[model samples]
Target: MPANTAPIKWAQRSDSLYVTISLPDVKSESITLTDDKLVFTGTSGANEYACDFEFFKGCDAEKSTYKVLPRSVQMFIVKAEEEEEEFWPRLLKDKAKEKNQVKIDWDKYVDEDEEEEAGGFDTSGLEGGQGMGGMPGMGGMGGPGGPGGGMGGMPPGMDMEALMAQMGGMGGMPGMGGEGGMGGMEEMMAKMKGDLENKGGDEGEDSDDDDLPDLEES
Candidate 1:
């Protein structure tokens, strides 16, 4: 049993988890989904790929659907009936032993929909201090042990690119000039060039008197 290279990524949301797999050259007919298992048989380049994964918890199979892309597949797994709206410790349960492999820790999962993050600052004490934004008033401004904290204090778990891609549409990237960052720059340059050309024409008109012949009366 050799190691696998299916390359799957997962992220948790308030109500669901998004799981994306690199499934290039996979036919829609070759994909299968069950209550707690996912199997895909496909080919990429000269190699044949067979990806199979069984979930630790049951999901709403009827609600869970996948979108096939040119090179991969994106799946949305609704929270299981028994699960609550909370952070998932890991994408999948550690079942390496079942597959005759050693168990390895994977990146922890985060809730994508929650804005009240503690920068992953772990704090647990008495009083009304055990909240997301850190101990009571000790939150905000991106500080430690509180919400709005920086990502440094937290363990690296999020697929930042994927998270941002999903968030990019919802939050809309700032300074992107509305869908066209460089296009905005091109528009500005074109306008500047047009203005310069108009200015040149104005200068030529102002100097038209200098080119006038003194033989106007002659």
Candidate 2:
């Protein structure tokens, strides 16, 4: 499964670096921070998001902290050495990889469970003796409903199993999985995009406004 790519906004202060990523609905417990990297998974609107950052400047992960907001996450990372003065040219020291983890909410942060679950469909009304009435108006005859209700009038056969399986496959597509897998796809795309950009850079492509420039120690 591809991880969702999350866009980031960051700034450096004398004491710390503030890194924020748009994530309206994130799996809070999914957030992880270490001396070298940071990672998390989340969603916004109809799309999903994810991010993995490997820092160039060493950071004190123990002193770092983050807050999950209604639509974003704000993180603070303390400098490894208070006296050192330097700023990062880019958010990551190297190409990022999607290393995803548990996606439970803060309240259920300790639980090990699936991030998404199907609410389950209701078929009781859809399963009486009339049994689905042959594609709506096709209920030709036989029962009080007419030929549309008859056994011979019924379609060849309702392969519920096959149909359900096919539907499940569709649900697994991007933006489809009740809520899980689709979110990760964004991360995959983001990573691929980053790779392409880096490749172009390797080929001597000109840098643009989109590329972050080196910062002078202040």
**Per-model C-alpha lDDT, please?**
0.52, 0.53
* Model 2: lDDT of residue 182: 44
Question: What lDDT tens digits, residue by residue, belong to model 2 across residues 1-218?
Answer: 67567767665544456566756765633676777777677667766677666776677766555556667676656667856655444556763331232221232121112322422222222221121212222111233233244353443454646544555566545564336454455467788999999998877856575488788999
lDDT of 2 at 147: 28
lDDT of 1 by residue, 1-218 (tens): 44255667666555565666665765623556666776766666566656677766666655555545667665655667663556655555555623442122234344344425713312222112112111221221223433333353332355666555555556545575556554554467799999999999988778666878786664
Query: How many Å off is the CA of 79 in candidate 1?
Result: 1.7
Query: Which of the numbered candidates is closest to the native, going by highest TM-score?
Result: 1
Clashing pairs in 1: 133-146, 133-147, 134-146, 142-148
Cα TM-score per model: 0.41, 0.40
Point out the worst 10-residue segment of candidate 1 by lDDT: 125-134
